[model samples]
Target: MKKAVAVILLAFALTGCGEPKIDGSSEQAFQTSMQKVRDSLAEDKRAAFNDAIQVIAFSQVSMKELMQAGSGDEGGRALIDKKIKGALAGKTGEEVIDYAHKIKQERAANQ
Candidate 1:
């Protein structure tokens, strides 16, 4: 009886000494939380980038139209830059498309 009890206690002690079981559910939960954080950050970055692109696109299209219309005149280039720079100054690359359309409209009207 004493040997049996000692063996049982030893087994329990050995089990307790080993690493805890963080099973599949806990790991899954951790992974899910991490992924959510990453996804949220990615979305925010994408939005900022889109905004920058919108600004740049507006400037590019505007400059292109103005330059084409003016036949490469320096005055036209300056005018285009003056009109579009303010709008595009703080934008990210992905957000420049919006401004490009606006610039296109302005250039068309000026021509």
Candidate 2:
């Protein structure tokens, strides 16, 4: 009985350790990358780039809304969803959100 209990406890602990959490540090990295993209656009004064930025921002905001919903913040989630559906004109909501994060990482790395 003691051996079985010990084995089960060990298994439980190991399983928990396998999943990784995105904490404050990772979130900061994401934000820093986004800022760099914005700064680059401002410096260049490219009209097309500015338009793309607007779309990307819409996507990113929608993603945040989805995350808020998952976190049990229903009001925030609904607002995000409504904004995404109503304001975003070109890209699919999912693609826009995913691309924005990808761009954020690329911007951070290039800087």
Candidate 3:
């Protein structure tokens, strides 16, 4: 019974672990990640986890813009999604947003 239970639990956990969430918007994505972290982790870790998720979601916006720029190209959009999801891995939301802002500043200065 224990072995069966453990196998089932492991399989279920693995399913969610490998996939990255692609949210429609940064805010929505962060909210979803925060909720998941809040539900699964201790209270003390929720804030940090939430911050990390926020960064991913924020950075994810760049992907959306890129996809939109290549609008109607399904292949291009799919590629953008994959790249953004991978980039969001193990990052803080604040860190992502701050980096984005810095890039924007550099672009503006160059202009």
TM-score of each: 0.28, 0.26, 0.37
Ranking by TM-score: 3, 1, 2
Off by over 4 Å in 1: 1-70, 90-111
| Model 2 clashing residue pairs (backbone) | none
Better of 2 and 3 by TM-score: 3
> lDDT score of model 2?
0.53
Cα RMSD, each candidate: 20.7, 14.1, 8.8
Cα-based lDDT at residue 11, candidate 3: 98
Residue 29's lDDT in candidate 1:
49
Mark the regions of model 3 whose C-alpha exceeds 4 Å error after superposition. 1-72
- Kindly list the per-residue Cα lDDT of model 1 for residues 1-111, writing each as its tens digit: 999999999999897664222122343543453334334345656454445445553555554666664796777766555544544443333334444556567778999
Lowest-sum lDDT 10-residue window in model 2: 18-27
User: What is the Å distance of residue 89 in model 2 from its true position?
Assistant: 21
